[model samples]
Target: MLYINQQKSALQASTLADLAEQLALPTQGVALVLNRQLLPRALWAQTPLSTEQDHHIEIFQLVAGG
Candidate 1:
């Protein structure tokens, strides 16, 4: 349940969805990597995040241009 939100280091999270919901982001563009292994975004909903797990999240934002 330890998650790094953007700039900050580590924080406690109840669940991965909770973190995504807090950020108002869909699980699609966000990538989860635990202990240096990349986790597929498709598994976000099913992935069980715990306090014992060390996770790194990468969120991607899309920009529109003319």
Candidate 2:
């Protein structure tokens, strides 16, 4: 049982893409950082996340371009 902090959803997912799907957020609009490392958007679908391991994930919503 992993504990994801500061996250709205309670679903236990291994990847950001799964989390996004559970949270109903677009994968392209959010930025995720794990353990202080910035995860590239291209790797979101494959990057594994662990809440029990004390991962620091920073999520930012991207604004549409003008």
Candidate 3:
């Protein structure tokens, strides 16, 4: 199982892009971090996610403020 935003998740994803799709993440104004490292958007499609190990993925959405 992997953790998304500190919550445990059983969802299986082959790549970062897959995860984003599963979560219905927006194409813009979002950031993803894997194992404490910032993941570039360009690499999401190729980045592989393993189900055998415990991984932590953090997703942050940019919010507009006044």
Best by lDDT: 3
Task: Identify the superior model by TM-score, candidate 1 or candidate 2.
Answer: 2
Cα TM-score per model: 0.50, 0.60, 0.88
Candidate 1, 56: how far from true, in Å? Answer: 1.4
Q: Write the residue-wise lDDT of candidate 3 on 17-48 in tens digits.
A: 99999999999989999999888888999999
Per-prediction tally of clashes: 2, 0, 0
Residue 49, model 3, lDDT: 95
lDDT of 1 at 17: 64
- Model 2 gets an lDDT of 0.66
Q: What value does the lDDT take at residue 65 in candidate 3? A: 100
- The lDDT for every candidate, in the order shown, is 0.59, 0.66, 0.92
lDDT of 1: 0.59
Total clashes for model 3: 0
lDDT of 2 by residue, 7-61 (tens): 5445678887776677676646676666667777787789877765655556677
Which ten contiguous residues of candidate 2 have the minimum total lDDT? 1-10
